[model samples]
Target: MPESFHKPVRRPSSMFDTIFGGHDPADTARVAHSTAHALLSRVREDPEAEVVERLVAFTAEHGIDTIASLWSQAPARSLPGALWRIYLLQLMVHEDANTSSIIYERGRHELASADPIVAGAPTPAGPDEMVALADAILRGVFDGDFAVALNRAASFSRVEASGATHLADDYELTEPERSTALTTKALRLSTFAADLDAAAAHWRAGTLT
Candidate 1:
């Protein structure tokens, strides 16, 4: 497993305080969903390069927990949920590009699908390329076709899940515990892939929210 996955998630004290300080759950959900839609609208309506860049870099500067707090609880097919998944995917790559690239490489070889192409990753994507690919996918959400971006994320997740499963098999014989952990990770990634793919379909059908 990547060291980044072991790192403790940092939740800002102020945000937790606000969440626990009498803020209603319904109100929080409303704000989260509305804010997600509003942010997407703002970028789509006026997608200046500078504005897109700033939004793309928001989680990098503020930490994933900031947006995770707001949107993590949203329904999987909703706008906020889709946005949260995309940010989470980007964080995974940015935090541990090396492991991501290795797993992706394995999946590229094992999986007999067009996922690698849909994911828009370079052939033999290295750590640096993986990071760039993650950023590009997030940038596409703000500046390019939203459905396409979601599809790309879905494909990426699927490929990684496939890779993780195969790696688990490789470790099953000698390292049972590691194999079990990889299997669990693969299952989680598979779920994310399904949700992201559904979200993409919803977006294309004009019902993402």
Candidate 2:
């Protein structure tokens, strides 16, 4: 585990804070959406590689809870929601690159689709490759193409989910608990794939926000 993962970071209060008249739900949503768009807009217009890299490493240095506080509540098909998912995916890979690489390799071998190609991961996707892939996908969101990045993420998720499912099956007999956990992970990854795909479509249609 990374030292950052062990650090205590404060999570902002949720919309539920509205119950205590702390934050108005409408205001919170407005701020979240505006901030998400502003950040993306700024980086895209800057055309600085360093700027993009800084944004890519923002969560790692400051903690994902910072951005999650802003976008976590957004709709899964919206821009803020898509950004949140990408950051979350990056954080996961960074926190457990070895495990991520193992499952990704399994997925690359088991999946017969073009997803591995679409994901753009290097062959044999070791831990370093997995980390690099995560960063590249995120960099695409800010510097390259947003919809394309989402598609890549969706494909990656599908491959990983497929791998997890197959691995779960292999462990079913002797490691029931591990199998069950992998099964759950597969289901969650599948859901992420679906959501990201939908988000890509929404982005293309100019309705992601």
After TM-score superposition, the amount by which residue 92's alpha carbon in candidate 1 deviates from its true location, in angstroms, is 0.4
Query: What are the models' TM-scores?
Result: 0.88, 0.88
Please state the error at residue 59 of candidate 1 in Å.
2.1
When summed lDDT is taken over every stretch of 10 residues in candidate 1, the lowest stretch is 13-22
lDDT of 2 by residue, 8-124 (tens): 554333211211221567876787789989998888887599999988888777876668668777777788878887887787788778888899999999999999999999988
Q: Candidate 2, clashing residue pairs?
A: none
C-alpha lDDT of all candidate models, in order: 0.83, 0.83
Clashes of each: 0, 0
Model 2 regions more than 4 Å off: 1-23
lDDT of 1 by residue, 94-120 (tens): 777898898899988999999999999
